[model samples]
Target: MHPESEDDSLQRHRLHPSSLLFSFLGQAKQFFLPFLLLFFAAGDSWELWFALLIIPVLVFDTYRFLTMRYRFAPAELIVTGGVLTKNERHVPYARIQNIDLKQGPIQRLLEVAEVRIETASGAEPEAIFKVLSLSAVQRMRGRVFAERGEARPEDADEASAGRTEPAPRPELINSLGPKDLILLGLNPGRGMGVVAVLWGLAWQMGLFDGALNFESILKFFTGSEEGSVLGYSALALGFLVSLFLLSITWHFLRLFDYRLELRGDDFLSQGGLFTRHSTTIPRQRIQLISISESPLQRWMQRVSVKVETAGGTGQPAESRHWFAPLIHRHELQGILTTIDPHLQIEQASWQSLAPGYRYRMHKLSVIIALGIAAICQLIFWPWGWLSLIGLLPLFAWATQVESKYIAYARTGYGILFRNGAFWRQMSLTMNEKVQVVSQHQSPFDRGHRMASLRVDTAGAGQSGHKINVPYLPTARADELQADLVAAAGRGEFSW
Candidate 1:
C-alpha cells in the first residue's frame, strides 16, 4: 500500500525513558568481570573508594534514564543521546539498505528484537533499536518501505493516476520442502569437510578452539602407552566417524527450518536456530549469479548457486556466499529460469593458453618449489630434502590443474571466470559492477601476445572482488577493459 501524505499519516513514537537504565546496565555488565578483578587486586581502601565511586555513576544513569528521548518518526528514526555531548543520529527511510532483526538469548527471553538498519554509506553505520516488540519491528519495516515509495511485489499498477489501491499478495511459485532441505544439506559446496579440516589445523596452530576440539581429545586418546596402538587407532577411527556425522548434522540443521517465499520481485530466505536471520534480496540488487561444482560434487551430480548482491555481507576469509548448497548441476538452468526468466545462460568458447604461456607458468611454479626446498635444506638437510620432494608433486599437480581449468567466458552482460585446482569455482560479475579494469603484460607474456585482465568490484572483504584473466590475448583484454569501463560509466548493472 502507498503511503499517505506525511501531514495526514505520519506519527511518532518515543521510546520509554526507562530504556536508558537498561542500556546502562547492559554496558556495565560488559565491564563487570574486569571491575571485580580490579577490586580484588586493589587494597581494601582502594576497593572502598571504588565502591563509593559507583554511587555517582548510578545517580547519573538514573538521571539519564528519566530524561533520554529516542523518537521513531514515520519517515525517519532519530536518536539523540548523551547528557553533555548530545550525539544525534538521523536515519531516513530512503537511504536504508536493509533492516536486520536480531535477538540474543536474553532479548528473546524478554520478547524483544534488536532492529539494525544498514545504510548504503560506505562507513557501515547502523542504527540499533533495542528491546523492540516484534510487532513494532514489523510495523517499522512496513512504514520505512512506504516512506521510500517501494511498491510491494504483489501490487498491481493502475492505468488511472488518481486512484490508489492495495496490492494483492503474490502466489507462491516454489517453496523448499524436506527433500530440498536434505539436498541442500548433502550439497558438497557447503564444504563442511574442508571447514572441519581447517578447524583442526587452526586448533593445531593454537589459533582458537572452535566447534571441533581436536587437541584435548587427541591428547587424551594418545596420552598412555599401555594400549597406545589400539587406543590411538580406535580414537582415529572414532574421530573420523564423529567428524563426518557432525558435519552432516550441522549442515542439516543449518537449513532445518529454512523457508523461501517469493513476493513479486524479491526473494526472502529465513532460517537459523539460535539467531534467526531473514534476507530480502531484490532482483535488481543482484550483480552476478554463478553455478559451480567441485570434482566431488560433479561426480555426485550436485552444484551450488551463488548470487552476488550489492550490499549484503561478503564471503568469509575462504568461503563463498551461496544461495543454496546442493542442487543438481543439470537443474541449475531450470532453477534460474524459474527465478528470473530474463537471466541468460550462455556457454561461450573459452580462449586457450598459448604454448609459451603454459610453459612459463609451469616453470614459475617449479622454480618457486625448488627455491622453497633450498631454503628448507639450509635449515634441516635430510628432512628438508624430503619436504622439498613432497612440495614438487603438489606444485606439479597445481600447474597441471591451472593449465586445464583456467578459462573465461564473456557474455553480452557479464563475464564468467572458471578455475579450480581441486575445488572448482565459477564467478560471474556484470560489466557495470566492474569499478576498475586494467590490462598488464609481463615481458614473457608480451612475446606470446598474451596479457592479464583484472576486474574489480565493490565490497569483497579484504582485497575486494578482483578477478584476473591470466593469459588472454592483449587485444582481447584491452577490448574487454574498454567495454567494462564504458558499461560502468553508463550505469548498466545487471545480474
Candidate 2:
C-alpha cells in the first residue's frame, strides 16, 4: 500500500457534494412549511421572490457544507461544523460504539450513505455526516474499530503470525423462509392490528354494536327475516377472508427477504422491500439483547429479537432487532448461541419470579384500573362502570399470567430478565454494561418480605431503563444484589 494513501486515511475529510441536499432534506420541514405558507398566503407574490427566500437557504447549506470538516487523529475523531458558531466534538476510540451507515434510494443512487457515529453516551448521536460515499464511511468505520490496514509493515508480521485463515468470512446465522417472512409481516408493527380491524368490522356488522340493524341488511341480502342467520354466517366468513388477505399483504411489505447474518464479529441485518436497510451492529458494543413474542407468534412458535447498543435510544424501526423477525422458538436458542454460546435462553428453565409476585402486580393492576375507570366515570357513569367492570378481570388475569413468567437468569458474562404475558419481553444484558443495580422495597414489598432489583445499563431507556425483577425473596434479593455487583465489578467497565 502506498504511504500517501495510508496518510490520506487519517487526513481531514469533507462530506460529499450531496451533503447540500442532505442539509436541505434535514431542514426541509422548516424550509418547505414556511415556503408553503408563503405560497398559500401570497399566491402571485411567491413567483416574484421564490428564489429570494429559497436561494438563501441553498446558499447557507452550501456554505455550511463547505466549512464542515472531520479528521481521524491518533487518539480521537474530531468533527467541526456550523456557520456563525464553530462546533467541535472529539470522540475517543474508547468511547465510540459503532460507526454506522444508512442508505436510502437517493443515497443509493448517489453511492453515498448517511454516516452516523454512536458512542457510549445514550443520548444524541455524537456525529453524523450526511451523504458520504459508502467507501468513505467504511474507511472511517475500519479506522475507528480496529485501525484495519493502517499498521506499519514492522507490526504486520507480528499481527499476521497470530492470525489464522482470515478467520472464516462471516456466514449466515439464520435465513427466513417464505412462511417465516409471512408470519413476521403478519405481526408487522402491531401484533393485533388485523384482529382489531376484524373486530371493528364485526362491531359494524351489528355483532357488537346493536345500533347497526343487521336484520334489515339481511332482508336486503336474502329475502325474508329467516335469512338473518345465513346473512350473519356469510358476513362472518367474509370478515375472516378479509382478515387473512390483509395479514398476508401487510407481512409481505414489511419483511420481504429478511435475513440476519453474523459477519466477522459483527451482527448484520439485511431486509425490507420498498425502503431497503442493511445495519451492522458491533457484537462487543451491544449492551442489551431482548427476545420478544406476541400471542400469534407464540402459537406459530416464533419469536423476534432486539439488540440495543451502548448509545442512541431512538434507533430507526428497521434497525431495531438482531434476530427476532420470525425465528422459531426452537431455532432462537441456536441462533443466539452463535453470539452467546454460554447463555441459556430456554423459557422453561428460567428461574421463575417469587410465588407471591402476582399479588403485587394484581394490586398495581387494580390501581391502574381504578384510575382509568375514574377518568371514564367523569365522562359518563355507565361507561365508567363498564370500563371498570370490563377491565378489572382482564387486567387481573393479564397480571396473573404475566407474573407467572416474570423471571431472571444469569450467565458468567450476562444477566437475563423476562417479563410480560401476551407480549413477552426477555432482556439479556452483559455484566460489563451494567452501570448500576438498585434495590427498592415499597411498604407493600416489606410486608411481603420481598424486594425489587432494578438493573440499569446505558442502552436501556433514560428514566425507566431498568430491568426490574420485582417480588424477590428479601434474602434472595440481597444475595442476588451482591452477586450482580461483584459480576459488574469483575468485568472491564463498558458503557
What lDDT does model 2 reach?
0.70
Q: How well does candidate 2 match the true structure in TM-score terms?
A: 0.77
- Can you write out model 1's per-residue Cα lDDT over 1-495, one digit (the tens) per residue? 334333323344544333564676775886587678777888565564665655667777666544444554545666666666777788876666566666555565665666667665544435666556665565555555545544332321221121232312543433455665555545544456677667555654667666655556766777763555677567657866676566556655555566555544555555555665555555445555656676667778877776655543432321123466567666776657655664456555565654466687788888999898887677566677677668989988988887788788777666767776666766667666676787889897788888888776654434223467787877778887887787778875433
For each candidate in the order shown, give its overall lDDT on alpha carbons: 0.61, 0.70
Report model 1's TM-score to 2 decimal places.
0.74
lDDT of 2 at 320: 42
Give the range where candidate 2 is weakest over 10 consecutive residues by summed lDDT.
Answer: 158-167
In candidate 1 the C-alpha lDDT for residue 312 amounts to: 36
- lDDT of candidate 2 over 85-160, digit per residue (tens): 9988888866776666667777778888887777755456788888788666655654555432244443222222
Stretches of candidate 2 above 4 Å error?
A: 1-6, 10-12, 21-30, 46-51, 69-71, 80-89, 148-168, 188-255, 313-322, 347-349, 362-380, 383-396, 462-466
lDDT of 1 at 14: 46
If scored against the real structure, what TM-score would every candidate get?
A: 0.74, 0.77
